[model samples]
Target: MAGRLLLIWRLLVRDLRRHRTETLLLLLAITAATATLTLGLTLHELVARPYEQTRAATAGPDLVVQAGQPGPHSLDALAPLTTLPGVTNHSGPYPLAFLALTAGDTTARVVVEGRDGTPAAVDRPAVTDGTWIRPGGVVVERTFADALGVHVGDTVSVAGHPLGVTGFAVTAARPAYPRAGWHLPGSILTEGGGLVWVERGDIATLAGEQPLSYTVNLRLADPQAGAAVIDPSGGDARFRGWRFSTGQEIADTNGRLNAPAQQALMIGSWLLTALAVVGVAGIVAGRAIGQRRRVGLLKAVGAGPAMIAAVHLAEYLVIALAAAGTGLAVGWLAAPPLFRPTAGLLGSVGMHPPPLRMVAAATALALTIAVAATLAPVLRAAATDTTHALADAAVPPRRRRWVISLSRRLPIALLIGVRINARRPRRAWLVTVNTLITTTALAAALMALAQERSPVDLGYSKLPDARDERTTQAMILVVCVVCFLALLNTVVSTWTAVLSTRHPLAVTRVLGATPAQAGVGLAVAQLLPAIPGVAAGLLLGILTFFAGDDNQHAPASWMLTAGLGVPLAVVALTAIPAVAAARRPVADTLQAGVR
Candidate 1:
């Protein structure tokens, strides 16, 4: 048994080394799918990580309460909540001044909050750059600072009062920039802008007449009891006219911000995997044709069907494992940049190894695709009779009377193209499926671009939505990858067709067909399948992405472009290999076929 296993390993290694190009192609197909899958599966956890880190580092609050009305005495109403049961520690009803801020030529509405020189027991913002707030100096929230392109030494004006930028900080106490808190002197329905921190005295000095609201951050002994602490059913007057939020609610909101990106990646990964399956099946079919004689040779040496199957399976199993590892590493490294952490969170988005479950899931997917593709071809080859396998004769193409009758009336190139497709209907379908996936991805990308053109209303002003921006980016990325794999698949399928039909095409060339006619015939086979694929893909893409969204519509121009462009692209890709095969010396091809 040990000796047989050793022999199988040697055979697998030698076979892979001999077909290095095919081996690499298999690896590329599987790795592309697996890497995308890894990114999709792990992105949500990665996006939520910074918030958790910030919460732990800053001793973030369990509950935050904001006064509904702004006045100098608002703190008097909020002060007693710090003494409520389950409130272990608290940061007071700090004064909040709603004002417009200007830095350089850019201006935006901001919430300027007053803080002490020393850190508060709860909800202390962690300074990421420079120092904490000081006299005549103001700290900017990290995300807001990024938007303004300001740093520690720069100065920004608050309600027209210029203050030197003291430092940059991140906090779990509020949602990231562009949503720091609500704008004041209006209904809280208005969109909030950014956040800046200054000393208590500066707040009174800078806002002589601006309305002031108060907010208190509370750290509960039991974080989950936040709802009970602020229960309105108690009829406590202090709870009235105050907005309260729990830590869990805030974390959930932060996580929701990444929902668009996560959905795009998850959907894209499945599309890519489908394309990979079609491509791998073609590669396996082509390799099986070339390996028939090898199967016969193994059988002659007294190898059983099980051993022969094992030998073929081992080669792909090794490649699958390698591809899975490479994919996991690529996905893990690529995710942080693609996610592009918003200035809202505390920690820099850094590379962390994916968790063990993600690694396992990606590996399992790769192995499954490899095994599924290779099994049918391996089993068929093993079952071939020894005599027929040793002869290595081409399987005669089954002639259909209707196909023959129809082909006889067509032009020579069209006749040849139609017959080639009829001979291998399965290959034609694979080409169709490949084109379908590519066109669907292209159409989805166009739809996303169309939606981006519409303005997003934020109640206060129109601004680009961060979620929409990320979703658009993710779609673009997925389209690029799917197109590349589709391109590779096109080339591979065309070349495989050329090899399989070499004998018949050579005979036709010898019988008076021009080389150009033969090449065009080969390209026509691919083009025919692509037409239906393109049409179906466009319909599917529109239904999948554009349905139920009143703001989004399928642009006719975009649909027409994809419907016409994909088939042309397919013809162009197929022509390279087709022309090369047609130019091969007819005599040599005929001689090889006879052997």
Candidate 2:
């Protein structure tokens, strides 16, 4: 006569212990979500801090001015801006060039920040690799060295002039156009980053030829120096203008400039969040199904619906909280790279830890997504009639006359598919939604790549060198990989769900349906819902381009491939798993599903 609440708690705890695999998966899901949010919030800070420290110790300037023509006028033009009300100090008239350099067996690119002085602290590069740039030597960006697998003592040639990499150093400046965007600049641009520090006297000889291509850099005394100049056009005409950067400004700017990388961070965050939703919910639903029959016995004993719902929902709450906390802790440790961009960018403006609000927001978002995704299945179980729920071992659908009639008239596989789909509409919807997310992500990534390579609004290609192109391409490859994995997981999850209906499937197999017929039936069950899902996903991929983006137009080939390819790939992936699962003995399957 005692209440079932205690029984429910005991049962829930027992299930948690018994399902170690499910619990681990739940932990992984939450961990990924937590890591992504933490990374998104903290990347700039992590990347920018060391650079800021280096910048402060050295005389790194605040603003960089680049000109199409390196001439006296460029220098003359900067003279007045330094005299602006808030403007204080200045550093260059430094000549910078981005060139593809070949060093022995390795062919790569180097960014040359040609200066007229020794490496300093206020505006200097701290020589970490070797000595500072002497009359004949150059300093390399440490990351660039890490990429090329070169060392401080190695030699790198730019435009035929081979110079020893005197030292590996960190600077206080970085361009959005090159590598080091906290945004995942893909692998190519992200790699091969080099800075050749040429002596003031050797500029002409090192450059191959230079009247000095036009560039002026300024170092502002205050943080607010060129704040108003972000818009670009409103500044003085003769000055074509230089943009001033602060340590914090560097981090924020890096985020904005690296579109693909930032998108990656954002997508990764949302993706993990979505996966956690599906993963946690699946485990919840599976448990709820088991609990449903027992709850029916309780309902017959006059147990209240509210109590039933609370008991089931409470188990999820505990799991979710544990997941959230564990995930946050993992993210806290794993996400420093995401918060700060590249070293140089960070040093231009100091990086700071985000306020407590970001952490609070991350927790809230994870909880909401997890709780909402699980509630539907739990609520459905709670609402079912006690007798109907308890009597059937494998619950039948309410009604699917349309599916039954169409199946009766169709090919064996098609008919089987239609019926299977109708039997479990939720699974079908899940497959469609998962497919949509992958395709949309791929589409968005492809479009991002196109933007980086072309940057239409700015006309000139974002990077004019092979190294830059390579970095962007690397990012695309990751997009492709991520999409493939998400799609693959969906196929696996679908197969697992289908195996839960072995009894019904066994009946079909026993009804003179050949093994091939049974297989087709299984395939159809997956494909019927997939057709719409793929079509819709393709539409979403295209629409996403025109959505909030620059109204960019993609070649039809990309759209078709992304849209159609995703669904087909998913369907194809399911084939092997479905076949393997379906091939098991009909008797065993029937017995298990009924149990």
Candidate 3:
């Protein structure tokens, strides 16, 4: 057992050093998968951690009740809330008013909160830079201030009042600038806007007859009980058009600020993983085919099937281990930016590594893909016959009666192309399946972007913000990454096919076939399977991502174009490398086996 292990180890090490490019390809494929998985798994925590930190730093409220109409009467409406059964403590009747702030060339819609210099028990915003609300100074939310490039001592005109930006602060009571509040309950009442903290006496200057909402922050014994604790029927002096939100709901809403975008990214990661599987499998098969002579020689030397298989499998195992570590590091670093869109609400998005469970799962998943991809090819190599391995002759092309009879009437290039595909039907099918998976992901991403772009009549006015744009960007990023890897896979597969058929192609050139025909033949082999693959991908994409969203409409024309275009595009991409390989001197190619 020790002797056999030593043999396998030596063989694996020698082959890895010799086939450096192939080894690197294997490493990159798995690394991409693991990195994507790590990012997807840690996305929630990426947002959750910052939220918790900010919530802890500032005594964020459990519930917020806002009266739509402003005045002393509005304050009176919320005074009865302290007597509620579950209410423990409360803050406000703070004055909330929406007004525009202008600084130089920039004009920002901002929600100004009137606060006293005294600190409160609930929703106490922690000062990040400079001091809290002072007599003649205004404090800006950290993210909002960062966006406008406003610093301490900078003056900004708020409702035509030039207030000094005395400080920067962060709070858990409200979302950062541009996502003032949630969309469902009181979206209009609190339209997306930046937040500002000002002295209570400054409220009149900013208000200037502009509408105001009197907001009260409530701390309940049971934060989860929420609006249910409030008896609407009972004459508790409830204000007309009052909106109430629970602490738990606020936390969840804050946590999921970028939920749609994160979900899209996670879905994209899984798609990339699928592509990695197909790509790795194709690469392994190519490697096995290329090393057929080596496999036969091993068998002739009296190596057992199990021993030979281990040598081949061990190469990927070593690479997989290295790739898992690289991928984990890359993903850990890449995840912080993904949560930046919600950084305003969360305060400081920390670079916390993905949980250990997630890392383990990602590593396991990558290793599984590596093993699965190589299994079939390794088995084929192990099962090679000693006599055939020593001889190293190419497989005889199967005679096709229909093809031969019909080819006389067709162009030489097209006929040759058709013949090449017929010779290796299985390989052609595998390439086709890969194309299908790639195009399906592309189609789904496009569909998602289309949905995000199209206007949805949700029976209310929607706030203009970065949330939708961020989601679209996430989908686009995924599409780009997937397409790039798929492109690389296509090139590699084409090059491998060219290498395998070099002898046969050289013989054909000697029999009056031109370089162009050989190249076309090579491209044709990949394109034939692509037709059905593209069609299947389109259908699958529509069924998978387009079915659930009622607000989205399908772009039948675009899907059709994509299905047709992708196969032709593959042919174009494959042609250059195919032609280059075909143009190699026939003598040198024929003598390659002898060397």
Specify the highest-lDDT model's number.
Answer: 1
Q: Model 3 compared with the native: what TM-score?
A: 0.81
Question: Model 1, which residues run further than 4 Å from truth?
Answer: 68-77, 83-85, 104-106, 183-190, 230-238, 452-461, 552-555
The Cα RMSD of model 3 versus the native structure comes to 4.7
Candidate 1's residue-wise lDDT over 1-595, tens digit each? Answer: 9999899889988988899988888889889989888777666666567788889899899999887788866767777788977888989789888777888877777888999998888898999899999989999998778767898899898878989998999888888767676565534654647889999889988887877788999998888887577673756675565677888877777777678788898899889888888888888888887888889998998988998899888998999999999888887778767866545766533445677888899899899888887888889988998889988888888899999999999999999899999998989999999999999999888877777454334333445566777777788888988988898888779877987889889989989999999999999988988888999999888777765546476589878988888898899998878988899999999888632
Looking at model 3, report the run of 10 residues with the lowest lDDT sum. Answer: 454-463
lDDT digits (tens) for residues 381-410 of candidate 2: 778888877874677565667767666889
Give the alpha carbon lDDT tens digit for every residue of 1-595 in model 3: 9988898888888889898988887788888878777766656666667777777777777788887566677778778886788889888879877777776667767778899899988889888789998877899988777667788999998878889988998888876665555232234444555788899999877788765667888888987777766754634464446677765665676556567777877888787787777778778867876687888888878898998888888888889888888888877777677546544554432355567787787789788888888888888778888888777778788988998888767787777777777777767776777788788887887677577553212122233345576677777777777777777678767866887788888988989998988888888777877888888898788778855647474577877777877887798888988989889888999888621
lDDT of each: 0.83, 0.59, 0.76
TM-score of each: 0.92, 0.69, 0.81
Native-to-model Cα distance after best TM-score fit, residue 116 in candidate 1, in Å: 1.8
Compared with the true structure, model 1 gives a TM-score of 0.92
